[model samples]
Target: MAVLTTTVLRLEKSRRTTKKLKDNVVAYGFLAGGLICFGLFSWYPAFRALVLAFQQTNSVDEPTWVGLENFRLLFGDPEFVAAWRNTFYFTGLALVIGFLVPFALAVLLNELRHAKAFFRLAVYLPVMIPPVVTALLWKWFYDPGPGLFNEVLRFLHLPTSDWTNSTNTALISLVLVATWANLGGTVLIYLAALQGIPGELYEAAELDGASVWQRIRHVTIPQTRFVMLMLLLLQIVATMQVFTEPYIMTGGGPEDATITVLYLIYKYAFVYLDYGSACALSAMLLAFLGVFSALYLRLTREAT
Candidate 1:
């Protein structure tokens, strides 16, 4: 009787072990599918691009290893330097305008007592619109003749100015469009961060006779610093890759004033059929962004 009982317990244990192993295999099988997809679509492309950066290739002929020749040609090009400068300038402008507007809008929205949902929806509506559509809409808005913006100015008896037509205004006009279109999502994120802040902190600030701006400076900013920093990094990285706006709006026009690194990359790859140069430029951008992110995160982590 004892031997039979022990044998029954052993069989049950064996069955449980087999079930656990089967479950793990099933989970790993699903995970493997996702890994395979990423390997094919993401990792492989990145690796291929990196390899092509060092090799002369048109995707037809056998690629010849050129080793830094593409990069040398890239650096020698005046437009390459101009693209970097323009990208940095755009990033700075975006940080100044795009970075602040969303936070301010979020704060205003958070303070409103009624119709909060309506305001939030209004703020986020632009985000739902396709980026290409947004760019097209802004292109019309920036048109000098019979454009909505110029019309508004004329209606107010103000002088109509060149928007995307002149080099002076072209880059900044695109910046404005980008800020308006992208600010919606940033505002919503700030709003979420604001909501997560403990209400009691605001109450304490009020009790201490802190004014609105003071409360925001002393309490709100500190609480949301992490979110702000993260968004700052993301914004810089994103603005550095400003392609769509230039592509759709300015086409890197007005003497290449609005040309950015990514747009230049596009020109290299598609227009000039210089895939090697394009890949080299992409590698440079990737390296810069990777280093910047790492350093920024380390500094921010230490500060916090």
Candidate 2:
């Protein structure tokens, strides 16, 4: 009788183990296609880019290992310095204008008790348009003669200025176009974050005689600090890689005033046929962004 009981228990355990193994096999089968695609498209390309950074290749001949020659050439170029400076300036200007406007708009939209849907739609409408379309639309608006902006200025009897045509204002013009096109997404994100804030906090602040600004400073900002930090980092990363606005609108013209690092990389690879230097520059940008992302993650984690 004891032997029979032991045999039955062993059979049940064996059945459970087999079932578990079969389930795992099914799960792995489902994941296999996605894993293969990721390896082929993402991982392999990334590894190749890294390898290309170290070798000089024109795609027609035997590749030569150039070591640090590409980096040396990139750093010594005057346009490289100018490109970094311009990129930084664009990023800074973008942060000053683009970053705060969306948050402010979100806060204002949050306070509205009527026409909320309409307002939200208005804010997010620009994001629905294709980036190329937005760039072309703004390019027309920036035209000195029949441009909408200059026409408005002319009607108001104000001096109409050369926008993207001049080196003085080309970068700023691009920044404005970029800010207008991109802020819709940020506004929506901020609005979502604002909505997630508990109403009780505002009530408590009001009970303590906090003014509107005081409530926002003490309660609203503190509650949404995490979202703000994350968005700020994202904005930095996005602005650093800015290419489309300058590429489509300015063409990095007006004495290279609007040139960015990414634009420079594109020129190096395609225009100059120097893939090695382009790859090296890309590697550097990737490394910098990776470090920035790591620090951002660590800081956010600690703050949380």
Candidate 3:
């Protein structure tokens, strides 16, 4: 009886081991497929760009190595400086306006007990529209004479300003369009994070005589600090690479007030037909973003 029992146990253990191995094999197969796709679509292009950054190539001729020349040219170009300045400025303004607005909207939506679904849908509707279409729609609204905004201003007997045609306001105008189009996703993210907070914390704060602002500062902000930090980093990165709005709306016009690094890259590659310089500019942006990401992760990890 003891021998029979031992044989049965051994058979069961072997079967379980085989099943586990088979499951792992299947999981790893799926993972390998994803990795292969990423390699072909993402990693390969990045590697090619890096290599091309140091080599002069027009895709038809044999490439010649020219280390640092492309970068030197970029540094000497006045447009490069302008592009970086505009990018940094846009990022700062976005942090000031775009960053806070979504959070505020999310909080307000959270507080609403009535028509919650309808409001969320409205907030997120812009996000569902394609970015190109959003740019076109806002472009029409920004038209100087018959634009929707100018018409409304005229109706109110208020002065009409050139929204995208003036150097002073062109960047900010693009920023507004960007904020409205991109904020929906951020609001929804913040809403989800808000919903995950413990209700008990809010109750405790209320019991302690905390006002609405105090509760938000003490309880809500602290609870969502991680999400906020991550979004801040993402927002900075995204704004720095802003291209679509400036590309379609301003065309980097009003004396290049709206030119950004990515738009510059597009000009280099497509308009100027300087693939090497374009790749070099892309490399610079990549390096900056990479360092920023690493530093951010390191700091956040230490904080956590």
Candidate 4:
């Protein structure tokens, strides 16, 4: 009887092992295609970019290794410092003008009891428009003479000023256009975060005799702090990579006032035909952003 029981137990264990192996094989089969696609498309290109950063290529011959020469040339360029300065300036201006506006609009929109969907759609309509179209449209609006903005200023008896034509306002003009075009997406994201907040918190705040601002300061801000922080990082990154507005609208003109890092990168690759320098700059930008991301993650983790 003991020998028979041992034989049955062995049979059961073997069956279970076979079932587990089959299940693992099936799971791997499902994952294989996506893994291959990511390796081929994403990982391979990233690795190639890293390799290319140290090499010189003209797209007609074999790439020659230049070590740090490309980086040295990039650092020596006059526009390098200006590009970074302008990029930081744009980022700061964007934070000042763009960041808080969306959150404020979101909070206001959240309080609205009627036509909420219509208001949301109206705000987001600009974001759906093509960037090129937005640039062209805003370029016309910024025209020094007879432009929409100037006309409005004229009607209001205010002094007309050069919008994009002057070095003084070129960067700010680009920022305004950028803020208008991009505000919708952030507003929607903030609105979504606001909606996720529990109503009971707001009720408790009101019961404590908190005013609107007090409720927002204590309840709303705390509840959406994570989303706000994440969006702030994203906005900083986006503003740092700004190229299209300055490219299409100002052409980095008005004494290079609107020249940004990405715009400089574009000029290196296309205008100067210096792909190596462009790649080197790209690698540097990637490293900086990587550090920023790591720091942000560490800070957020510690806070939590």
Candidate 5:
């Protein structure tokens, strides 16, 4: 009996040691691989972009040092300024509408019981389509006369604007398409978050005579504040890079209204072969995003 007990103890010890060895191997392997990959693909390329921002090149051998000339030129150029304005406009619109709409939709979806899963799937279905495909589909829908959008408006005796070609409506039309593609994923995420909230919290609020607005304001909003902030920051950064829609749909017209920072960089590097200026523009956008991320982190830290 004593021998059997000793044998069992020894086996348990052996198993523990084996587990520790396996864990160590996995942890070290992950750390080493992560560091190597980050250094090779992310860190090195980031520093290289900073270097390229200060140097002049056309994708050939050793770029010449140009000091801050690229940045100077980027700032002084009227087209660059217009792109910057467009970028901010898109960012603001996306941040305001994108985050809020998804949150509101998610809350409404949470109230749904029958076909809840179906509704969730429906909300996220559009995001499954590729952005370029979504852009193309929206472009067809915006066609002046025969497009479904215009046809619907005409059927309703409402005015049908020439969406993508009209200087007045082109940007808004592109925004609507982008929103349709993006809204799904945001809604899904928000739905998950809302469902995670305890029913007890709502019940408690109700017991306290809290109105719907008060419950949302004091409970829902507070509960989801971190997620909301993070998504807002991500949307702002992502929207500032609006490119594919305008590229494939409007070609940065009517009158350059939709030319964004990323579109400008594409024109600089590919069309004009101005590698240095493209890198410089990329660097500026990177700086803005970095500042935004840092500020968001700081705000979240303070809140916590």
Candidate 6:
């Protein structure tokens, strides 16, 4: 019987090999097309960016290779350093405040006994607003003199605060706007993950007399760990690359307090006409995110 099974397996393998060889032309044709497109857009551009990072361009004419001058200047540049600091600070703040809120909100939304669609829509409505419009609206809200924030403070006799203008609060203010803008998407993601969890797990936990918190701590969290990691990594990348809010609202101003990584890159490329330095900065950002993504992938693979 064992010899017969081995013979059958060999026969199947031979048949499969023959079929694949017969279709080799079509397979190789598709592979060639894929490689061409990938090279044209992804691979070639990536290599070109690295090349340009080592070269100088005045935004016209041929680029001149300048070796490591761009990287050296980038490291020594004061504005670049400040932008780096602010960008990391924003990412840290958002990771803490932005990461947990949406998950909690999603869990709450999932538990809704009535008006579920209304609650979902209400939470997601702000995300539908154009980013520029959202930035402008927040600018109005955070306005020191006549803004709603200060007005509310005065009504409640709380101390009035300079939100966007004050260096101490500008980054936090931007984080608030980011959290508000992104909460809906995060909530939706968590909702889907939460719903994907099998009902039988909860039933078994309940039968074991597990309290609600106990069940959530053990079952809910473990089941959704993959989704949590995905969202966390995505937030890290997105928050690290933040530019639009500061660009539109502060102009990297209030004493350059709100300038972020991509903001610095923008200044290098467009404002300062140093495309080389900009590419170098971009490469650094890519390196940072690559490390994060690699770690996540390793952890995920090990778990599975």
Among these predictions, the greatest TM-score belongs to: 1
Instruction: Report the candidate with higher lDDT, 1 versus 5.
Output: 1
lDDT of each: 0.95, 0.92, 0.95, 0.92, 0.88, 0.91
Rank order (by TM-score, best first): 1, 2, 3, 4, 5, 6
Candidate 3, 107: how far from true, in Å?
Answer: 1.0
lDDT of 4 by residue, 120-210 (tens): 9999999999999999999999999989999999999999989999989999999999999999999999999999999999999899999
User: How well does candidate 4 match the true structure in TM-score terms?
Assistant: 0.91
Q: What lDDT would candidate 1 get against the real structure?
A: 0.95
The segments of candidate 4 whose C-alpha lies over 4 angstroms from its true place after superposition are 1-26
What is the TM-score (0 to 1) of candidate 3?
Answer: 0.95
Candidate 5 clashing pairs, residues 3+ apart or interchain: none
Q: Tens digits of per-residue lDDT for model 5 on 227-253?
A: 787787788878988999989999888
Candidate 2 residue runs with Cα over 4 Å from true position: none
Q: Over the full model, what C-alpha lDDT does candidate 6 score relative to the true structure?
A: 0.91
Q: How do the residues 91-173 of candidate 2 rate in per-residue lDDT, one tens digit apiece?
A: 99999999999999999999999999999999889899999999999999999999999999999999998999999999999
Give candidate 1 regions above 4 Å deviation.
1-13
Q: How many residue pairs clash in each candidate?
A: 0, 0, 0, 0, 0, 0
**134-185, model 1: which lDDT tens digit per residue?**
9999999988998999999999999998999998999999999999999899
Query: How does each model score on TM-score?
Result: 0.96, 0.95, 0.95, 0.91, 0.88, 0.85
Candidate 1: pairs in clash: none
